[model samples]
Target chain A: MSSFEAGAAGFVLGAACGAAGAAALALANRRRLGRFLSFAAHEINTPLTAVNMTILNFISGALGPVEKTQEPWLKMLREQAERLALIVGDLRDFIHLRLRDGLSMHSESVDLTPVLEAAVESVSWGFSQAGVAVRTRVDAGLPKVLADADRLQRVFVDILYHCRKFRDSGGIDVAAEAGLDGRIRVAFAYAGVKSSARESALALDLYYPARVRKDQLLTATGLGLGVLRLFLREQGGDLSVSNQPDGRSVITADLSAAGGGR
Target chain B: MAAKILIVDDEPAIAENLQAILSAKGYETSCAFDGSEAVAKARHEKPDLILLDVMLPKMDGFDVCRLLKSDPHGAKLKILMTTGLDRMGDVEKAFQCGASDYLIKPFGSVKLLQKVEKLLSGA
Candidate 1:
């Protein structure tokens, strides 16, 4: 072969080799980032867990300091600790969902009734202390949802928590009904101090789960509204919000019911 | 004469917090700072239950659990894997090695005591 043709052939081979090398490096970086996130999340959890538990002892009256002066401060500490703990948990789940394949991580046939009941149980003391009643009407024998029971409980608990936080001297009505479109819809309806964000909250049908882009993940962190929706979608459901006819904000999540491995 | 519990964790804050709470509940509580320390304490102490952390220095929680489970004294001991690694995969691994129960981090007083009570009651 001529010198010119030989040089051209060598250049083509070198370009291919460089492209392969770059691809390998990108893959390695992705794996390293995942490892770092996992380690960070694990480390953060230890101290956070200790602080949260200390607060839990107080909240449960284990400390025996029922002084009237410390009531407000104790409540605030509990709420903040709960919030931080939730964020760490949500971050861990997000990391796993990002690093792993998808819903296959925790997908299973889950009964929604017990999950909601547990969520309600978790926040029962808070609701009672705030004089906010909670009522639930989960239909019997409702088709199970193919989702992670833990995350599903979190969605319900987190939703109820917000309602209880922003409550306005009334109660919460949680009703679950089997939807006609191969789904199970659970609603958390409450009447709270109305705000300007009411409309925007309903209009926030932004992260649809199916289209969870990488940039979207970066933007959505902690236990934000977007994160809640992402968790639902990650389990093959969609979250929507609508104002009740009685002026209450109703946050509804429709998850695909577990039917024949759906 | 309450049951004894070994709190195994690398973090002093977590270990002490748990130790305080368990002691307050009338259970005899001991502390171990790492996986190896945990094994040594379990072997010598022969506690009724152990609140074992997943991550530790020198040796990790899983290895400690595996080691204890194989020991004759720890054969029937109740091991509760307590850690921040709340993922199902990790939980399953602990269970595979014979964990009595799994409790995630940041647990409340009620939850922790309830689990401890149940475990001691042989549930």
Candidate 2:
């Protein structure tokens, strides 16, 4: 081989090696930052949790709610604690979503019915306590899907929490069935209050605020449905939302079924 | 007799705060500042519950849990891991090692007590 050809070949190889090393270092740094953010988020929760709990114990045990002097402090403390928790939670979710972006879903043969039921059960107590009704009707014979059970459940639970924000009419209906496109489709239809139409489109975006034209502006602790949609799409599915003719917001999610367990 | 708890953590503030909260709730509590110390107390004191911390000197929380679970009398010993680690794998590992429950660090007093209450009640 000619001397010029050999040198050119070495130059190309050296450049490629340098680029690879730089990429590796960048990835390591990204991972380190993600870890640090997660740690910080957890630390934030700790003190907030302590203060809130102490106040509650004091109100319930040490000092009764009848103590007028402490009532305002307790109320204010609770409100602030809740907001802190929301901020920490949103930050945590955003970090996790970013860290997990582009990663393939961990595949397992997950039954759609049980996962849906569990998600609803996890949050139904709070919903009922707050006078919000949730009715779940999953098709009895629906096939299982190859997906991550935890993320899939979070997708629905997060949606339900979102429903809690925009649902002023007091109820949400959940149903799932096989879609025509060889997928399992889950629908969440809930009564409307004052949510803007833009929300139906933009609600999936990270930290998207659901605002009204004149009066009530509602925001939730959940990061957003966009990440959940991303999770679904990565695992052979899609998510979308629309406003019904009857003035209700209906969210539809489709997941490719596994035909049967692997 | 009130149920006894061994609070295992390296952080003094977290360990002491938890001790105060659980003690106020009418339970007898003790503290160990690391994983090896936690194991030593679990064997020595044989407390009804041990609040194990994940990150510790000598050994990590998972190893401590494994040791406790494998101890002849540790079968009935209820372990509740309290840590700042929030990964799903850690939770699964805790339960796999026979943890009665897992509480994330920086949990509020009421939440902590609730888990403690549930574990003790089950005991």
Candidate 3:
């Protein structure tokens, strides 16, 4: 064989080896990053938990007597702590979903009543602080739906949080009923802040567009909607948003009923 | 007598804060800083409920739970697993290892109290 051809073959082999090494290094770094994120989440949550427990002690008068003026400050502290905790949680979940195939869920027959109530409870404080009222109605004896209770609760929490951001003073009505299509539908209706069609579409995107006005921003982190949508889709459910004619908007989530819509 | 609860957490501040909260609610409480200590204390004290933390210095909370749960005397102990890990896999593992309930860290006081009360009453 000619020396020129031999040199060319050697160069090709060298390049292949270099590319393989780079890919290996990247995979290792990715794994390292996943581990680091998991560690960071646990570490942050531990201290945050302690702080929350302490705040509760002070507010409940378990530690001592809280003066009238101190009460409002305590309330504010509690709210801020809750907000920080949620951000940390969302950050962890966002990274987890990106790194993993998807979240693992154990679907079972879950009563919608408690799940809706818990979701409302989780975000009710924020709603009240924003001068918004959330009224949840689960039809009496509502059929159980097939879902992961925890994930379902979070889906509602994200929607409620989203509603709180869009509507400052108006009320939000959350109603769940068995859809005729053999699925359970939960609707969140509220007067929404006006936005462009593009902005509305981008709201559920991984990150809300920076071009949107400050007051019209959907979320500070813009992680909830995207994560919640992925979670719903994973559970054989779907989420949709619609802007009504009267400047009001509606977000609906549909889930299959347990026992094949029994 | 008020129900006794064993709070197991490596973080001293967390353990102390939980003690104060439960104590104020008229429940007797004790603290264990690691998984081995948690197992020993739960065995010796036989508390009505154990607020077990998953991460520990010696043996992790899941092992401690599995160990105690294997003993006939400890089978009835209501172990409420607490963790800073938000993974649903950990939650499912906690239940698989016989945790009575699971509470993610940063949970509010009312939630803690409600779960403790419900577990104790149901016992």
Q: Give the TM-score of candidate 1.
A: 0.80
Off by over 4 Å in 3: A1-21, A139-142, A209-224, A260-262, B1-5, B24-29, B39-49, B69-78, B98-122
Q: What is the C-alpha lDDT of each candidate?
A: 0.77, 0.75, 0.80
Query: Between candidates 1 and 3, which one is better according to lDDT?
Result: 3
Q: Judged by DockQ relative to the true structure, which candidate is superior, 1 or 3?
A: 1
Better of 1 and 2 by lDDT: 1
Q: Candidate 2, residues A47-128: lDDT per residue as tens digits?
A: 6766655565555553233477866566566555644665575566557667534343465778888888877876665677
A1-262 in candidate 1: lDDT tens per residue?
8999999999999999999999988877876786688678767777777787887777677766677888767777776676676667777776666653343357888988889998888767667777888899988889888888877887787778767765666899999998766678899888865434544353344453334544331122235455688889888887876666677867798888888423
Q: Which candidate has the highest TM-score of all?
A: 3
Runs with alpha carbons beyond 4 Å of true place in candidate 1 = A1-3, A99-104, A120-136, A158-173, A189-223, A241-250
Backbone-clash count (model 2): 2
Instruction: State the lDDT of candidate 2 residue by residue for B38-96, as single tens digits.
Output: 88888999999999888777899999999989999988999998754234457777898
Task: For residues B1-123, write the lDDT of model 3, one tens digit per residue.
Answer: 999999999999999988988998899999999988998998899899999988899999899999999988777789999876366677888999999999887666788899999999984
Candidate 2, residue A112: CA error in Å? 7.5
- All DockQ scores: 0.58, 0.30, 0.51
True contacts kept of each: 0.67, 0.10, 0.62
Q: State the lDDT at A72 in candidate 2.
A: 58
Sort by lDDT, best first: 3, 1, 2
Model 1: per-residue Cα lDDT over B47-108, one tens digit each? 99999988789998889888898887667899999866346567888998889998987777
